[model samples]
Target: MTTTDRRPMYWEEFSPDSARAGAELACLRRGVGREPGNVPEMWRFHRVRISDHEARTGAPSASLTAEHAALTLFAVHQQSQRKSMHRQGMGLGASLRLLRQSEKYKKNPQALNARVNALATSADVPELAYHLRGLITQLRGIGQPLDYTSLFYDVLAWHSPEGQERTRRRWGAQYYDWAESKAKQPQTD
Candidate 1:
């Protein structure tokens, strides 16, 4: 087995912060979601968050919540795919790295997944907040949208087995289904 095979699963304890993170991510996929106030509430907070993100920019740990890092990475991945498709076009966004940027964003999930897996082995939930904060701050320093949360579900589900199972129930990805199936399959070890 390789590193992934040997690595401990991310959701070993499944705390409330993690669950809130998962639920928040889940709600986004459905609508305004039950958390952060429905549509208007979500948009209000999202807008404020955007402004805060811009102001904080390179140093975003101050603004990060329990769900922030996963949310950011999740948002980045969706945006990257859209960018790859030539869908979103902003001033500088249209001018540079559209395709290349998309490729970079596309690869982020696995990179993030690996990082989270490593962190999971050593860090607990609260420490994860600081760890994720550092991760986001560093990414933001390079001018990435490390604060975006447009695709929160991906980050939630990517890191949590519970979120993945819920996502599979809601959206139905064969990969998640396969991963969930591992619970039933006899272990090789």
Candidate 2:
């Protein structure tokens, strides 16, 4: 899963120096081969866009290839992570908006705080308010309200199947942490 350490699997195994370019017909296959379902929505969308472009105008020019798009996609991921890491919670109105969206908001204005406190306790995340803020940001990042019918607490982190697991991969090997080591260490309970 440490694709950040290896060459993008889409172009690995075959040596570019030895491989001959295909003319008249080109087959472009790409995947987040690091881990199954680890591929992000942004990458999937980028794939589709590339597919559409190829279908309409054939393969991209040699100067601008899928590798460039892949780099752009990875850069987008990195930029998003950077922004998420430093982002703070919503202000008063936004916080109130979140509270109103809560299922129990009509019952109590403090309901959101209580729910966040409970979530923070179970998640072992310090700072109830701050945790709630980050959780909300994560929730928004995952998708639209119509995508899932669950309440906020119902979804802890809604990354892709393997991307979600990637987040739990531990501090030393975190994908978002550029400084994290990519060495395959033994897992301990």
Candidate 3:
């Protein structure tokens, strides 16, 4: 197989109806809050991908760490949902913006805004994960799904200062731009 063929498929690219993807997600769900090596069940699904990434890059498997964090967050966001939580084209900022607009939170937007601010300013992955858990719970309550594939890559990029700035800018733009666009639309009424 060519190198491209060996690369792991992003979750968003996977067909929502694929049984193989469903099974893989279920396995990842079982790994919520667990460390990478501790989840022996996930090894089969993620190990080869992690190894392949390390081999190709000649770097340590930080991909393993990022994937673990993203998958665990996906599990939390997906719990008890009949539909897949890995929605294509939905990024974290967009999903959070929806959550901010939900009736449950519309009355008290500051609470959600504070959470988003905390998440954006997190100093490290562990801190980010901690803040993300709360937001993911809120997302789950509102049935807001995001693209786990984007999130995984975002987390991987978080390891670098430049990536953090770029990611934050993208998210901020998505979040605030939605509100601006909505305001600019002419109301039918």
Candidate 4:
């Protein structure tokens, strides 16, 4: 039983502004300034958000939206590329450590997680989902089973499926199966 074992099982609540600030802070801690937009993934999220907002409010600011969209695309693309570089055999602790070593992740790792989780819930839901799936796949390849739903609930404050119930179902099923198997086995001397 370590400190992690004693931490809260889950956290609930989502605040968009908090998430945005956390993200900026995370980057600053990593020694990186506000990243410029230039990648497809980041751009997609920005585009989705801008479009959604514009549709809702009938605001017409194509130039501003385009600029922000470009910046976001670059950021997400860079992150994905970075994740691929370190994916093999890296655990959460290792990843966190690596991130912290950089100027961008010096602050609370949990907070960074929340920021990333929030980014994933940005307007382009499908793109975020695909990118996350790839990241999770890479983590899994390294023998890590990322509990993303739990992570999102604990860290991010974005409008998206929290996946809490799904996580519970998976955990319960796995735990029960393990328990049943253990009960059926003869005791080892």
Highest lDDT among the candidates is held by which one?
Answer: 3
lDDT of 2 by residue, 1-189 (tens): 122433322222222233332210022212222221223432332211234655576554321232333322222222223122111222222333444455545466465555444533443212322343344443344321211111111122322334334323321122123333447456668
Q: Which residue runs does candidate 1 get wrong by more than 4 Å?
A: 1-117, 120-127, 158-160, 164-189
Tell me the lDDT of model 4 at 175.
Answer: 26
Better of 2 and 3 by TM-score: 3
TM-score of each: 0.26, 0.20, 0.77, 0.22
Worst 10 residues of 1 by lDDT: 85-94
Residue-by-residue lDDT tens digits, candidate 4, 35-135: 32322333322322235766576563433332332222223323322232222233233443344344554565565455445434445433444344344
lDDT of 1 by residue, 35-146 (tens): 2222331332232232455455544332223234443333332321212211221211121223223454455546544544443443333344344444444343344432
Better of 2 and 4 by lDDT: 4
The per-model lDDT (C-alpha) reads 0.34, 0.30, 0.75, 0.35
Which candidate order results from sorting by TM-score in descending order? 3, 1, 4, 2
> Model 4 misses residue 74 by how many Å?
27
Which candidate number maximizes TM-score?
3
Compared with the true structure, model 1 gives a TM-score of 0.26
Q: Count the backbone clashes (under 3 Å) in each candidate.
A: 0, 0, 0, 16
Which digits, one per residue and each the tens of the lDDT, describe model 3 over residues 61-105?
Answer: 656777788877876776666677888689899999999999988
